[model samples]
Target: MKKILRRLRRFIRRLLGIKPRMVWLTHPVFLQHEPGGSHPDSPERIRAVEAELKAQNIWRHLQTAEAGEVSDTQLALVHSRRYLHFLEANQPPEGKIYRIDDDTVMSHDSMTAARFAAGAVVAAVDMVMAKKAHNAFCAARPPGHHAKSGSAGGFCLINSTAVGAMYAIAEYRLQRIAVIDFDVHHGDGTTEIFKDDPRILFLNVFEADLFPFPDLEKERGSSPNMLHTPFERGASSLTFRRRIRNEWLPVLGSFKPELILFSAGFDAHRDDETGRLNLHEADFSWLTHKIVQTASSCNGRIVSVLEGGYTLTPLGKSAAAHIRVLAGKGRGVDVMRYNRRLKQRT
Candidate 1:
């Protein structure tokens, strides 16, 4: 009887160890039907990462989910109704791109894709709140950080992160939410939308003098709720990690955020063509670990969304490492599931 009880105890602990914290994956169709002629923001970005996740064997632990279309009412929480109307009504000609300014473009499926991407984030919020998983990641495209309240830019139509933050606060009554954007480019859109609100803390780290270069040091939001760390070209991962440890982490702890959202952009990777930062696959994994540790202290609520990582090899490898850490899968495990819900969605 003693031996049997010991074995049962061990079994319970092992089962608890393997249980997922929580993970959500967006559908592949979210990438399909874009308007550009093979732009960097193509479907291949998510596909490569998905393949690597499967190759890593980390995919099995994540719960699969579909990104439903966000309602206009929810979208209006962050964007203007007029702008939303314009985006829905104006569809670009097939096989041609309609520029939403100089940096953003629209294809036939852009609207639907954007809606689903936003919806995926909302689903993540729901899952986290329901305690289905410890945290979740939204692997959708047409990145949202650079999108503004009234205009679409930087290949982004809707600010998915912003919309998710709003949903958490308004719908779920989560106070003291925080958004940490690690994209190589500043999240100007998220900043613009939440500048006046004190309920959220928007922290960003991006390359200095990159696209949408106007958000420099003097660009203060309506509240002291914003912080920016602009690194020069060739900034090393060590330096980046130090900033997080010394600067960002302290502030985040003090804030005691109820929920943490990551604008996870791999464009800062060394091999990425978008920026000069020299981050590696290890950097993404370490950063994810740090974020998870931080979230664990606050009831383990985290949501990571795909932002910008263009190079196929680095993007796939880096994203795989990040997701591996998120899923609590042991390192070096190849063959992960691409979309935990892919089989169901099909």
Candidate 2:
């Protein structure tokens, strides 16, 4: 009955000239990657985003799809085979967790979840490039920006966005691609992988003196392809927006990329303590609109993969705001008021 109703809904939308604008991809495995012991990157992050979208009545309007299965060949495009072998060979025993580093841990199901996370981005790229949807959002985690080609860190196991970018270049033969990351922490791993590659233009906007790259200040201008823009702690929305317009937009416009990919991380939200930045949902919505506007030149192709947002409430609210814009639904939720209501409930 549910399947029939879904089909009927699709038909009715088509008849009414309501074309679906985006696809949302996720997987069940993402929920099982428990890192244990007070980890902020919990499965509840995904749940929070899901619950918020449903509450906002946005879920019903999206075209939900399962994550694609990424194979060894595709993963090797960005990662080494030996490192891949090590991950599979080193799966912890049942009920035991393996620590990759001080910040990264892997339960038995971690690799499986990581694979699917990368797969979700790959699938999104395919969907957007094929014009099946104007854009796509993959809600899979453990986040991947801090992950290197050979080593995992910052609770990341695979560099999913890098994998997806490489996949697009290989499969579709795209000469120029833009990878834009707005996470609070520098996308050091991604920068390392693509620093020498002229085909990729990496625009990274991150906070200065953060984890994994306290020395990032000295490393600026080392690579021509990778442009690093650092923001001081507690940067205001105006500063961020102005810098993006004055600094990043010109480079993006000049490149005229064939495909655009985003490493979307909401940890920089004002309410999320981890990021310590004063960005609200409105800021995120504004950025999404800018990205959509840029996509106008490239057949409106975009694939956004989730990165970091620890606080459940703001994470959900911010993610929903971004997705709603991507889905071509003008914003309706007042994030400040919604947060106040939740506090009242509590």
Using lDDT as the measure, which candidate wins? 2
Runs in model 2 lying further than 4 Å from the true structure: 1-18, 333-346
lDDT of 1 by residue, 126-241 (tens): 87887766788898978899889998988899999999999999888888888989889988898889895778888888888788785474775435888788888898766887
Model 2 residue pairs with clashes:
none
Worst 10 residues of 2 by lDDT: 335-344
Give Cα-based local distance difference scores for all models. 0.80, 0.86
TM-score, structure 1 vs. true: 0.87
lDDT of 2 by residue, 238-294 (tens): 788789888888888788888888999998899986887888877777787876676
Candidate 1 — which residues are off by over 4 angstroms?
Answer: 1-21, 220-222, 330-346
- What's the alpha carbon RMSD for model 1? 9.1
